[model samples]
Target: MPTAAPLAPAATAAARAYLPALTGIRAVAAYMVCLHHFNPFAEGPGLGGFLHNLLLEFHVGVPVFFVLSGFLICLRYYGTEQWTGRWWGRYLRNRVARIYPMFLLLTTLTFAPAWLAHAPDTTRLWLLNVTFLRGFFDAHKYSGIPQGWTLTVEECFYLWAPVAFGLLRRRPRLLWLQPLGLLALGCALVLGLGPLAYEGLFGSFRFMLLYTFFGRAVEFYAGMQLALWYRRGLLRAPRGPRGLYTAAGLGLLLAAVLALVAVRGQYPYGQEAPAGIALNNVALPAGIVLLFAGLLTEATWLRALLASAPLQLLGRSSYVFYLIHFGTIKGWLRDYVTASPAGQFVLLNVLAIGLYYLVEQPLNRLLRAPSAAEPAN
Candidate 1:
């Protein structure tokens, strides 16, 4: 009935800045994962089980985050190539400043006391987590923050993204080659190291397909392609209706998730199976790219809601919340404050905000001070 709001400058500007609605989407993704882990819905064979299983598939949040990372990284740094030592230093410094400091602090805090008391075993696990090598081993991936496994996938992408962009610059049609090669490498690892059966090294096909960056690189590539089109000003909105793309994106995402729920037969979730893997690793990311493109170009109510001040703050602090949602901090919350799911969600968000301002922000600033605290790229 009324006119839609204008899009944010970050959405369409040539200058690279963070999009507010996308930041809000970060909040949604982190919270979806938290809910997936701490779901309170009743589990039964009928409608109740269906509802619970639907929530379980909220693991799709990880894909949303992956796609966002790819989009933002490419959007911000795609063509800003210097390729010199100083530029590489600055770029890596920025990425490290953004992620590593808080992750290191929290990860150490997670394992320190246990390491002190139980030096040998805990020390090795602590080393694995701190180095992020734990993510490569299925037996150890859940040792520390649990969700920290995603960081491994992220770091791999970070190291490889520039190379990918450079290759795409030369061989545009071979864009899919990067992810395909990664998939082949993963299969090799499974066939080679999997035979060893040594501590779940290289892991099962399910682990390789579902968890590793090699298999999940398609999601990032999807985001990268979206960024390329968007930066070229090709991601135009329709003349009248504002939310059609948003609605379609939501429909596609829901259809994928519901399909995953439907096919969970004989496995914990549908993604453990071959068909489920294709849907999650590919189809789900397609929905996310559409959703993000809509958010970037249109001024729908969804965009306005995501751009609101509170959601912005929540989105800013969402990384902290994602890290703390299920592990040690949640335990403390359950022990000290409230045992209820809803209550803990609220309390955890409050704490995450506090940590963002008090801890992550300060460390990020200090680390990036040598180079102005911006992205190295």
Candidate 2:
């Protein structure tokens, strides 16, 4: 028989890399976020009461994504001059290109049902959602797609990133300082410092500029720190007892997820029900950031699993799925599936994947176009 055609060197080289594994991590995060949105298999509304807390406990995945984004931004930008440049216009342009189209699309999608039913607050909600001010005011807190709250946080970070990088420019090593300082200030406010100062400051619209924005900054900075560590070779690539690391990281994640679900059910909407525990806001995000860092750093089979192909696809498209799957993906599912938790999840995930391939991948091509200026430095 004729010898098989020799494998292309480039193809072989591509096969040996680890980026796909990182993509798989992205997939896991996206799935967790989807499950959280489904609100499924828990003890409350929507898809709750099916599984025994598996889905309910995994809501920490979003904060994990926040951390990952922070880390990846540092990885992509730390050495690049554009990120550390004089004007923020270019950075703003890139950020807008990445998020605005999908945001505008989702805002419009939220309006369709309202228009159909002539919902009274529809127009105002649309305006708030599109303008990135949805979470700043109490009136619009639960309006539009409920998931848009994270987008509001993301918008602030995008605006603040330049100021952040600028402040840390001279020291260079102190780059992590700015976001970390912001994070600590936020934690203090959430722990009631703001209330002590202004009597209702922490929970007010003005306070979002203080508390919510800073609280999530921790996740981002946690990621940035990891990126710095990895670059400095303080974080070696995984090559040890991968199985044990994977198992522990996953088990911790599961426990955190379950506890949050249990707490939510017992308390309903009152996050402070435990009185002194500070369960909802404090523990959950903290646990998520810790677990994610553990997973990203530790040597484990879990990391390898995260490096897989299918997971990577989900991970890369996470932003797209996040933006579209809420109303559009699930909204399309009404005709085909039973109105049960599992059915809704299956429908949403499938639609999310399709949207990723159809929309997200194509749009991300913009990030790859060569810049006219010298590549960031």
Candidate 3:
């Protein structure tokens, strides 16, 4: 296999800059997750049921976020010559500031009803959720803000990313083996412990892919590899009419996932069965890579649509939206919007925008700001 050429320091620094197209893609992925949770087509039969079932698998959006997280983190921090204490501190602080504040606020609000009622085990659940360790255990995985399970996965990646980047930087050749190593470990868990143990401890081996860093490491590896290729200017989307071919390839990948889901019948994909995990963790990420490549390289209609101002704003506020969309606000408004999926969708986005502006954005800025007492280094 041909090794990738080493990236120049200048090229690496350029890669660290923000990619607006990625933010746009993030908006799409977050909305896909929202629609999955909302199940706007829950009421209708036939076409509606089919669409609902397909959207159920839109949980692929979570993996998209995971892969994107890996890519962005690698792009920014990989290949550093020195790992100084201050650098590590800044890294951890940025990560915590980006994720924790909103998560803590939302987790507290989600569990407040049960906590107030003195529900059994509520305190224990709160401990797990607040610490972002709920994903480690089956009982608490779905306890508070059920969707927050993904954050646990995100946290795991953040925890290990710096270490992984350091090792990869020291031994660039190891990059080729990392994904296979993760895949081998996943297979070992499945074959040795069997599927049940994998699911019980790690979440669904098939659906949630053990809900741990190790289980889903391949997705992150894929993203990291993409970041490397991107830094080298090796990734390119098809141009002109050929861009349609790239779109078609993505469509086919989605169809393949849908077929796998359909084969599972009532089980639904990514909720149970190893087949779901296989397709989701593998095929879905491939599709996302293709879509991302298209967005970056081609001036296709879909890219234009995603790059639009509204979607860009949606992308920017997506994290806040993901945190709160399925919680108290949805429950409170369920009665009025229960009959209209479209209305529910619009309401969630509107509420998300308000929260982003009023709460998330301001808090994020404040948290990221340097302390007055800390002199600039």
Candidate 4:
């Protein structure tokens, strides 16, 4: 084996011992997103609709992704000095490599079918989608697909990630500034900028972008805060009793979900009217923070579940699954959903896992692999 050039000895040791629990979180968040999307269109058996609506309210799964990114990136920067090489280039390369290929692949698949069905020619929105700028406006008012909105926010983070890391690298303590700044921006946008979205001049640009990224960035920052706390040993989780932490975490998770349901249920997805809209913004951020905190707590049961082989494996391949599963599963089931919702949900899960192993996992490995049997970072 070739020995790689090392960072500081202590830093290298820390890197080697990084936890897989975070990957498990990725899997959990991705499943929430999947269930949220599936519930709106498909019907299912016992507790399916209930679970769908409940999780739907807490769709901070997307927000959770942002927080996790911030947390991990900040953790890496704090751990070593290798954080400063043309940071933007490296950030762009890795993010693009991680996201764009699958997005483009799925976009093609989705657009083809929708267009064939004589769905409106969303050429303008489609162009914005490819460029990762759909969130800049309601450029998604009529797009290639529904979930495309989340990609817009993801792109915004990717664009800003390098600068974000650079700031954190310089003043790690200033990490809090990132979220505070974003929260302030979100508030300002909601109060002042959101109205512009309704007005003619600005159209939907300010509200759309602000609502999407401005509000969501804080969740990512919250994740970063969690990472910082863990690093400094200031956020040690409760570990003595399994039942206590498990119950506490479950309660927090449930509260967050119920809160979302109470708010969003009043306004449903396509209502086109704003009532308690601020609640949606505030609730999602709070829910994600609580959910992640619960997942990362010192509870034995939660830890065991997160550390489980299956959850960790699914989480490891989650990015790929997120990118491809929608197209793959929907395409495969285009013929079957008319049968029964329960059947569809079961088949979707089975097929998603299978495709994850066959297509997504392999492609991800090949892209990041060094050689056989060696894991890719």
**Candidate 4: lDDT of 129?**
67
Residue 329: error of model 3 in Å? 2.7
lDDT of each: 0.85, 0.58, 0.72, 0.58
Poorest 10 consecutive residues by lDDT, candidate 3: 368-377
The digit string of per-residue lDDT tens for model 1 on 1-377 reads 12223334654464255578988999999988986887768799988877888998899999999999998888776665456777678778888889888899889888876877876688788889888888889999899899999999999899888878777777888988889999999999999999899788886988988888988999999999898888777888866666777878999999999999888788887877788999999999999998998898888899999999999999999999999998988888899999887899899899999999999989888877384423321
Candidate 2 lDDT, 62-140, residue by residue in tens:
6666766676555554434344343345656566766677667667877887789998977877887888777554445
Q: How high is each candidate's TM-score? A: 0.93, 0.72, 0.85, 0.74
Error of 3 at 335 (Å): 4.8
For candidate 1, give the lDDT of residue 49. 77
Pairwise lDDT winner, candidates 1 and 2: 1
Top TM-score prediction, candidate number = 1
Q: How many backbone clashes does candidate 1 have?
A: 3
- The weakest ten consecutive residues by lDDT in model 1 span 1-10
Residue 43 miss distance in model 2 (angstroms):
4.5
What TM-score does candidate 2 get on C-alpha atoms?
0.72
Clashing pairs in 3: 202-210
**Superposed model 3: Cα runs more than 4 Å off:** 1-13, 42-46, 183-200, 203-210, 238-240, 335-340, 369-377
Q: Residue 60 error for model 4, in Å?
A: 3.4
RMSD of each: 6.0, 9.1, 4.9, 5.8
Error of 3 at 21 (Å): 1.9
lDDT of 4 by residue, 1-377 (tens): 12223455554443344566667788878777776665653346567666666756545566667767766655554443234445435545555656666677667776675666776655654676688665555535325545666777777766666567557766777876886687676566556655665422224433543347765676667666666665554554556654554465456556656655655543564111243344344444555555555555655566677778887767766765676435544655766554565666556556557756776556655564242222222
